[model samples]
Target: MPSSSTQRNPWRYLRDADVLHAAVVTLLAVVLSAGIVWLGYVVHVWRIARRAPTTLRGRWVVLVFGRQLVADAPGADYRGRLARALALLREKTAGRVLLLGGRSGGARSEAEAGHAWLQGQGLPADAHVELEQESVDSLENLRHARGLLQGGDRAEVLPPVALLTSRYHLARCLLLARRLGFDGHAVAAEEGLPRTPRYLALLLMEATYLMWIDLGMRWARLIGHRRMAARIS
Candidate 1:
């Protein structure tokens, strides 16, 4: 027989009905808040997907963002992106083409490889192809490309720019381009590359980036840039 003090009533430990109701309400509130955040992210991704292939007119510069090379050669995804850029260049004879990418675990920069490849592809000799070989990411690519453009004699031209990249990557690229004061449009490369698990992962990663940028975390962006530079270096 247990002593009176040792006897435990499990019901006694349970909260009063009012208290349980309040706890349930709090839990529901938290879950609702979480659901709202998840919904917002879903909407953001939907908008990005919808806007990925939107084209803008006027004098446009072709800005091709770079991806990592596989054994010093552009991977299938990057090859598709480059092929699209090349197609745009062939179709639009007015604007200059800028190949933007930096060295990442390679003997040569991505821009260098792109320049060489485009040259070999019979790009017209009169076409002005500029190489930006020092940008490690999308933001850096546009920022550096902007600097290059401003440094040129055509600084005052202020043409609407066309970004060539994977469809999943175009939204964030366009966001950064607008932040850098570019009147930009996207020309996505959705074909050739299979929609694999890696592609889904890339989409999630890009969504996180868009969220971070939207949150205006300057320090986070700086740290991310440093980390990328360290990885490539």
Candidate 2:
């Protein structure tokens, strides 16, 4: 027979084991969360690489927007890339090109520079290249351009508008285009572009904008239903 002193408390042993097991599980969960984030980022880049080019041809208008352009510029990478995108659009779609941006600090707005460069590349003067100089951001660019495409008629069906921008900017710009009721596709201009600090800036800005809008939109919807019920009551 076992002595009384030799008897063990099973509940205490179970509790101690549970605490240690919980700590180990928590550490593993943290590592798994980090791994999943990293894997998601990798997958996003891979998908972008696969779908960045526009394959459809003929008269599919391509719209490109970006920052100002400077002559004798050292790092005018965005504008340079914008120019390439414009040229590619001309070649691929054989459609009119509309560019939008603002002139800041004596540097030519991207719209102006793109028009000049496109014309210099032998694009037509009157209708082939149009410029919208008032927009400061991608959403504004698309909204104002969408108005032009619709030609002041709310009932007009939007054309297959295609957006051309840097690789990192395509996804967010596409979302903004859809939000503004643009029935269009987006393509990243992936040719002949240098490394861009603007890419990281755009990504951070987009993530912040999306996070705020998502939370705010959800709260608004919830409150909206409550207000509607109150009014009905």
Candidate 3:
């Protein structure tokens, strides 16, 4: 014999197979939808990595985003980026460089390490170069680099510049650069899109990071979290 209050609110009779099953179905739908959206972004990243480049004519500054150092030396990928930047310098097309990265799992900062490697390769002392040794991640890399470019005799607005990094990394770098108001194009460290298992793994990891960042930004903006949104803006 239940009280009238319980009987009137018939939802009190809800069982696991009743309301709970519907809840589970709804949850699955949401999860599936999110997965589809994430996969689409992954495809977009892949396309950016594989796109062929045309001749870059204008003189531009090249921003070599840093990778972590290994044994306090530039890793293979990091050296690739350095080599590409040096090629631009030798081609006499780009005249300036800003190496962006902080110390991570290494005694020396990535910028310092990369600069040392470039000098060892015989990069002249008189080349216009800048080191951004304080950024720890891609977003911060672009943000701090933005400040450096605009804070002095650099430029009121960015001049044409190249974002130099690994092909797998270039997608996220370009995304952050555009969000931070950079005027640039992607310059791959490697010449062709890699299909090796190792490179595929790199692509997957980069895609996940990109999806996380964009989804977080959208959610923050939706909730009117202006400060969170501005962190990436």
Candidate 4:
């Protein structure tokens, strides 16, 4: 009954409302799924941080993750991680310590700075320490470390390994180490993990990174990207 002059073309609209609604729903579903997965990672990190680190019996290697330097000196986080390593070494828990990190816009590489700090703190006369000063990131740090450990044998066949890093960093470190087949335990730099604001902020950032790596690796494996999968290996 509509008059010809009153007729309208549906195509006149720039977009269909139904299509927009479906797009929004799809986007929401993806976001919700991602958040759920990310939350799982957060919970995983929290569990590790709150638990007591496994005590190595003897002759274990403590992989001390490198932190950023503050004004050419070890920052608080850096010192905290190093201090934990020092304590472990003094207790004879770990026979060797491997400091990992490269030059990150500083006068010296993180490992080198850590080595110097260890010296200033007076390392054990018989202590055997190695510095991995070429890895600019955590993945590279762990990869290079595995190579150093491997030599000719695989990393999993080596002695027990402990990943020592900041409380906020333990989760990522452990994840990477395990992915790299290190079978490593986590040692938190700061004693008694508390749910502080700053710590939670750090966790959020770490969670994002954790999720990024997890999803990336998953997608890579899903797509049969052997080289990418092998890199995560």
Candidate 3 deviation (Cα RMSD):
14.2
Model 4 lDDT, full chain set: 0.76
RMSD of 1: 17.2
Which residues of candidate 1, in runs, are more than 4 Å off?
A: 1-32, 54-58, 152-157, 191-195, 217-233
Candidate 4 lDDT, tens digit per residue, 1-233?
Answer: 21233222324232744333333443454497966766787888777778846355666789999877777678988998888888888889878899998776667778888989988998888788999887767888888898888886673476568899888888888878889888788888887886779989988778766766666566656777676567566
> How do the residues 82-130 of candidate 1 rate in per-residue lDDT, one tens digit apiece?
7777776666733788888887657777887877777777877777788
The C-alpha lDDT values of all candidates are 0.67, 0.57, 0.77, 0.76
User: What's model 3's TM-score?
Assistant: 0.82
* lDDT minimum window of 10 residues, candidate 3: 1-10
Residue runs of model 2 more than 4 Å from their true location after superposition: 1-46, 71-75, 89-92, 122-127, 192-205, 213-215, 225-233
Local accuracy of candidate 2 as per-residue lDDT tens digits, 1-233: 22233222324433554334433443454377865533444445435534677444666777776654456231354655555555665565637667766553334555666666656666634446677766666666887798788899878988887777766666666766776777767666665323558755655444444433333334445656454222111
TM-score versus the correct structure, for each prediction: 0.70, 0.64, 0.82, 0.81
Most lDDT-accurate candidate: 3
Clashing pairs in 3: none
Candidate with better lDDT, 1 vs 3: 3
Clashing pairs in 2: none
